[model samples]
Target: MIEPTHYLSSTVKGLKPSGIRKFFDLAASMEGVISLGVGEPDFVTPWNVREASILSLEQGYTSYTANAGLLELRKEISYYLQEKTNVSYSPSEELLVTVGASQALDLALRAIVNPGDEVIVIEPSFVSYSSLISLAGGVPVSVQTSGEMEFKLQPSDLEKAITDKTKAVILCSPNNPTGTLLNKEDLEKIAAIIEKYDLLVISDEIYAELTYDDVYTSFVSIDGMVERTILVSGFSKGFAMTGWRLGYVAAQPEFLSAMLKIHQYTMMCAPSMAQYAAIEAIKNGKEDVLHMKKSYRQRRNLFVNALTEMGLTCHVPGGAFYAFPSIKETNLSSEEFAEKLLMEERVAVVPGSVFGESGEGYIRCSYASSLEQLQESLRRMQRFVQKQKAGV
Candidate 1:
């Protein structure tokens, strides 16, 4: 008999499916489920950005763009980075518009990794980092972060993870699941370690614009590190354009060239209409982004306060939309509690173990849903916790 598994790449055979998708699938089958499992903004693409896409279609601008993406969009992305983060790039040589930050992360790994090279990932992180590193033939070295430090990376942890085989370290600030952010000082300390070891960095800053703390800092903002960092971000979170499938990579000329080749062979280009819409959004969508961020700030406070008041140990994340609360006090591992909550209370949230082992006693709740839904979720959660305590 013919077998598909025999034909699959060794890397494909070794990888597990994403953890985030498990709860998403569960929520789909449950009636009356209020889910905080999704990480994307609930907002739709802004009207002007949608209109721009429509106009592109009407004008018959449906042809494929340059292998790198639209020239105009690349220029706009370059300007946007500088204006927002004080990071400069040459549109022609330093930027490549890929499908999303997801793709850019993959491309960076593929471009730089040789088999058996090490890619350092700080956990609990977005699941894709480990999978992508594996797919690119690199070994993922997980350096665990803790809830004690609000899940932020410490200099000692970074120091312990590096060796001669280390090629790149993945850094996600305004991080997924935990929402812990790395401020300038945090970046500086980490950057110093990377510089000392002569290692490169693949920074995922997709949530940069959503930060509620002081201004977001790009790796490019720090001295000398920009030359060795592949800056990955997308319009999905900030502009509520998750479905648009547009994101970019900004890197040194040599690395950008290698990523472009892989992107060309694999994707050719991003969608034409998306490129046009993105150009308009970058040039004039500041108000739209700001309006969304302001709303998220309010939701953050509501969810965090409710969780702590209910006696679950929680942290106030500096950025991103998630509230990570420790579930140990409930005497339940994260998965067991999450499963029970869904079956009983019908509220859907991701178990911390889905991210990595370090996340065993926690669960990630996204505030991206409406306030009404969040309020009701809290009431249900309170009941759920109380019942668990009473041996119900």
Candidate 2:
């Protein structure tokens, strides 16, 4: 028989599996493993939000929503964005609901990228950015951001990465794996370069509500950026609604319309019940978000403090639930350290190298687990570090 691999798309064939899930799968196969690999929230979806979805099902509202999603949910999303970022999107023309923020991102890439277009991706970013860009037939140009700079994209570095073929930039503030929040001044500087280059921006703000020390600023809120920004966010991170698979994208009508064409053909619409729940979430879930944010802040402090005490040299994360700590002092590659920790200590984390070249020498530990689990994992990690140092 002919090999099935011969039939696979070259783009799909070239894509590597998610580095985060590799450890998660290993932990699943083992006994008594503590996994800090995945970035999901530890909290459950708020009762009110879940109840709304349940009620929708009871009302037999399981039919497909409009291709763009329910107008009510879109209106709520518009209001929420305006309230948070002082940027308003017309619910009818500028918003498209997607299965998840990931899908929204994929749609944005598919809509905007043409063959040979170059898209700049800021690294150590979410693992999917580069893959999705490649699948969109665009060359993913990585601009490495360092822990020395708090993983914030420097305007100079971004300028260096741009070229005549560069079409857009993918930016994730409150970035995954690193948890870095780019402030207004930082964004203003980057925005200047974006304007100078006449490039578009795909801003992933999924972790906006999880910010700890500073107020979350949407990239489009920067002067002269609204027209060029495609804002993708969802209910997963903040509202503990990951399993619900609900997210939305906000952009200018031209971009949104293009994405909508792809979304309509592929996804048709987001789940009807989840859309109902999202409506409730945006309307009444502020308190729930605040509660979860407070818990994550506390966990971030505890986890980062423990990592530092163990000599891991972590930068205190300003948002999101991850703590990216340097493991270079241990004299081990990130993969070696993470593999040894999992095998020897049954504590699972993602080696940062999988995120990008700049992510080498670090490991991403999510603090989204329970306090007790986090404490136990930290103890195990510390013991593992000591053993590695002692060379026994």
Candidate 3:
């Protein structure tokens, strides 16, 4: 019999499945498991947004949207970005809607990366960056950010990591896994480095609207940065619309045109009803986002305090909905800590090591669940930690 692997594309074959999903899968199979693993909002899409989608369907709007998505939706996105981030993009030429931020990310990488080109990835980030780069025929250079600097990417380290082959840098602020947001000061330093090196930037700002404390800043808002940055954002995290499968990219017309070509050939367009509903989301979803953010803030406090009281060192996350606590005190690897917690106490979390080697010794606990669920998970985790310390 012919081997199944023989027919697989070398790039696709080399890619590892997402580490975040592995623990989620395990938790799904187990009875009475409380999962803090997946970074998804627990809130349902706001009724108005859902109603708008339903209304669209009732009005016989099931046909495929334009290749660039609905003109009205794109215009709403353009207006929102300009008003919120101080960045402008022509809806007609500079914006392209995608299936999700995932597709926008893929499109951005594919449009810019060439074989052997290097893309700098800040580590302890979303798990897909390196794999996506590899699939685009680009090399991903990992730049590790540590707890010492609040997990913000250091300009000095980033400058040292760049080489002649480097083509682009991927940045996620209000970052996943770590929940650290880069401040304007830190971003200014990074902007200097990118400008000095003339590197393209793919700024993943999906969590921009989920920030807890400080005002969120977009990369394109910095001086001279808009010309070089491709901004990828969406309604998934902010609007509690993950299932809607809608996101978009904003860039200069020349760059967006290239991504549009790829999107037209592959995805063609995002879902029609989702696009219509997204217009409603962009226009009227502020209160819903604020309500969700308030809830997440309470949950973040609940989890972080619980972790600290249990003898784990946790940095208070500034934004997003995750609490990454060090598990080194338990004398187990991140995987060991997570697995034993799941088996013994029925709580699930993603091992930090899977995010990147620098993330090793910590486990990411999402606060996207409710307060009661978070409290229960914390109770189970506390018991698990005590048992580990007792050498059981």
What TM-score does each of the candidates earn? 0.99, 0.99, 0.99
Q: Runs in model 1 with CA error above 4 Å?
A: none
lDDT-based ranking? 2, 3, 1
For candidate 3, give the lDDT of residue 114: 96
Identify the runs in model 3 with alpha carbons over 4 angstroms from their true place. Answer: none
List all candidate RMSDs to the true structure.
0.9, 0.7, 0.8
Clashes of 3: 0
lDDT of 3 by residue, 1-392 (tens): 99998999988988999888899999999999999998889999999999999999999999998899999999999999999898879999999999999999999999999999999999997999999999999999999988777788988899999999999999999898899998888788999999999999999999999888888888888888999999999999988999999999999999999999999999999999999999999999888898999999988888898899999999999888899999999999999989999999999999999999889999999889978898889889999999899998
lDDT of 3 at 127: 94
Model 2 C-alpha lDDT per residue in residues 1-392, reported as the tens digit of each score: 99999999998999999988888999999999999998899899989999999999999999999999999999999999999999989999999999999999999999999999999999998999999999999999999999888888888999999999999999998999899999999999999999999999999999999999988888999999999999999999999999999999999999999999999889999999999999999999999999999999999999999999999999999999999999998899999999999999999999999999999999999999999999999999999999888886
Q: Rate the local accuracy (lDDT) of all candidates.
A: 0.92, 0.95, 0.93
Cα lDDT for residue 210, candidate 2: 92
Give me the displacement of residue 354 in model 3, in angstroms. 0.7
Clashes of 2: 0
For residues 339-387, what per-residue lDDT tens digits would candidate 1 score against the true structure? 9999999999999998998999999999999999999999999999988
